[model samples]
Target: MAQCVTAFKSMLQARLLEEKLASLYRAGGRIVGGVYIGKGQEAFSAGLAVHLEKGKDVYGPLIRDQAGRLAFGEPLLDTFRTYLGVITGPMRGRDGNVHRGRPREGMPAMISHLGSLLSVVNGMLFARRLQGRLGDSVGATSLGEGGTSTGAFHEALNQAAIEKLPVIIAIANNQFSYSTPNSRQFACGDLLDRARGYGVQGYAVDGTDLTACVSVFSEAVKRARAGGGPQLVVGSLLRLSGHGEHDDSSYIPDQVKSSPLGQDCLPYAESQLKASDLITDEEVRKWKDEFLMEIDAALAQASKEPTPDPFRENWRALSTAGLVEGQFEA
Candidate 1:
């Protein structure tokens, strides 16, 4: 019950923060890159994140994983700093806002190619195993239905299966990939079918059902940590928003919008908590108020902070520390 409440709170915080980010983006001249919110997928994202150990497990989040990032221990201020181009962010404001992460803390900085993240997490877990330090630790990464079609996804999952690595891959089948619906993405009948082909354990859950997400993700993490090899969770839901703030999402059909999958997870989560006697409407309101104030303060602080100056910044990559300027040219 406590875990569910905490995860729900993180989802609520992410939703509120993303909402503010959308408003900031719409106002113009405030944000740097695209504004993508998880919207209806928050429950599924947060569910996986809340179960992982921050310092031990590797988490590779995609563009729409604000909820997971928060639940995985990313500071609220970091999100604002990254989006607002504050030089103190994880990326030092040198990368896109959505590409921010703290690698040393087990979360790799995301690249534009979401499918590649699976291999990134696999490499990290494989490295820990090689060092004889992979004691019950697992690595998890997320993707959309579209990402599953990429070759990187297939190769990485195969690698994990072959090596019997503890890894969890969460796929949010949010009905559409960008403006493309699932019909155009793949013809597997169900995304879980891919899990069988990969020889990994698979779980399917309703992305809008907070309780189901919490239950499913918990089991997935547990199985992975217990040396069950890779686990795949395919969540069914709708994006509920545009691919970015620039899009109005007119592509989504009205029938799809009215479907059960289109239900907003945030309010549904609140209702779940209330029914379980874990939280009340008044408490939910208080949480929203508190989170909004915190978000406002963080944004204000980040807005006033300095941005990166190209001339004064070190252009060298962190991994090239031991090499001289001309050493790699040979």
Candidate 2:
């Protein structure tokens, strides 16, 4: 229990980090309309990220906020640049919504067509298998509850299962699809059962349980490494905000039921830690203050991030090699 407390407090700190990054992105010069926040669902993102290898594993992230990306070592300015479409971004400011984000050391760049990218991951798996690089590689995809209804979900899951590919399909069911609720979305009480049809291993965990989430993702990582194909993890996370920018909270129906705002995975962990003899209240206080300071520092430094390169407007044609012979000849 004490150990759980220690791990728990750290989990809260991670959530705080994510929140700070979200705020920075919202007001940042770049990524004005591209602010993706994982405020209530910190556990699954931070926990799973902790277990996977940054360089070897490729991530397909739709939850495009700085926290998730930062876990993989992405700098604040670079992410801002990516969101704002600046040339200085890792993807040369070319990556954006549906633009498989800048290919980093560990994760794949964000590709807009989420479901189809599974095929790309499978192709990478096949290549790795043929090259005798037959080790573990987790290709994580974050899907809201609404995505499961798409034919793409069925197709991606089926392809991975048939090929016995190494992928972990993580469904972050924060429970709302645009304006509709989960019941309106699916009859299945949990999304885990849906993957069973494809012979995929499935687990539906408490999205707020940080330790549980980490353990499950770690196991999934292990199985994929051992040629065990794919695992479907539908973690029920708390949603603190609506779908995206420009959304107003006045519309969310109250009688239909709602979660407490601070029902966040990280704060929950912190409270649990305080209840037990983990590190004493002082430790928690120290960590919280320390994390806040780091966030302030990140915010301050992020402001100083260089603006996107001015001469990168031709970035698209250059990166895609979509050049025509003598097209730019003087």
Candidate 3:
């Protein structure tokens, strides 16, 4: 294994953990006020995204919230621009929210179906093969553990196994998928364990454990890169908060919320490093203050910026394209 820098990784992890704390302040003002801040689950998204970017990988997000997207590579302004209906918003503010990630140039536009993106994964692989780019291309899809019970999951695994397409399907099993407890959705205690039956490697990790998450995803990415076919990782991330904007996550607890995995990314990474004497507590506090100040400045800047004109030139350009008449559609 290559000697990867741990200090920056720790800092990066800390920056991510800052979500739980900061989101609390902005949740009420956010689109779906009180967004599901996956406190302890930050590492899963980070690790998975880091791995996928090893190649020109495509992220097929399925309503798994925007944390993963932001961590994966979506710009900060693009994220906030989403609320303002700005063209800079991913997809020009069209398509669904949550999985509303920008396309990687030639990648397919994101679909809103729950687990249906699996078919797109297969199709993408097929198209790449036709173009003699199969080995050079790869697909990555993400879904909640809840979506695993759906038929799409089986179809994806079976097809990928039979065809030997390169893909990395990450299941962010954030304990509870919305209001429904995971137990109600499946009989399997661990979803990753099912990967072996489909003729691919499967593994589970403590999604909160950033180091472990990084190592696991790194290995999976290496395998996929070497054309070992697709792999499945069931990230057992603790949902320290509620399922979404509506329900109270009384099923979990505030105590669970205290840990790095349960609260958010930045602090977890900070605390972990601090515990291991990787960085000083003062340095952690400085980093937190710096990030918060940056956020405050960004929000303040956003407050002063002019709202985009609904009838701006791009809007007019769209109107002239017979978009309302559906000229672009097949």
The candidate scoring highest on TM-score is 1
Instruction: Report the lDDT tens digits of candidate 1 across residue range 1-330.
Output: 677898999999999999999999999898978888889999999989999888888999998899999999999998989888778888778876778888889999889885998988999999999999999999999999999999999999999999999999999999888999888999989899988998999999999998999899999999999999999999999998999999999999999999999999999999889999999889988999999999999998888899889898867875775585754655
State the local distance difference test value for candidate 1. 0.91
Tens-digit lDDT track for model 2 on 192-253? 87788889998887777766777787788778778788888888865676665545444566
For model 2, the superposed segments whose C-alpha errors exceed 4 Å read 1-14, 21-31, 64-68, 83-86, 96-100, 255-262, 275-280, 309-312, 315-322, 325-330
If both were scored by TM-score, which would come out higher, candidate 1 or candidate 2? Answer: 1
Q: In candidate 3, what residue range of length 10 has the lowest lDDT sum?
A: 1-10
What TM-score does prediction 3 earn? Answer: 0.77
Give lDDT tens digits, candidate 3, residues 1-330. 111123234235334433533454356553433344445555676666655552367766555434455445555555445444345556454432344555544234455456778778777776878888766556777778877877877887888888877777888877676757677888876686679778888978877666676788788877877788888988776665555546567876556455543645445655766676767867656755765666566545544555556566354335456565545655
- Compute the lDDT of residue 198 as modeled in candidate 1: 84
**Residue-level error in angstroms, candidate 3, position 159:** 2.0
Evaluation by TM-score, superior candidate among 1 and 3: 1
Q: For candidate 1, give the lDDT of residue 205.
A: 98
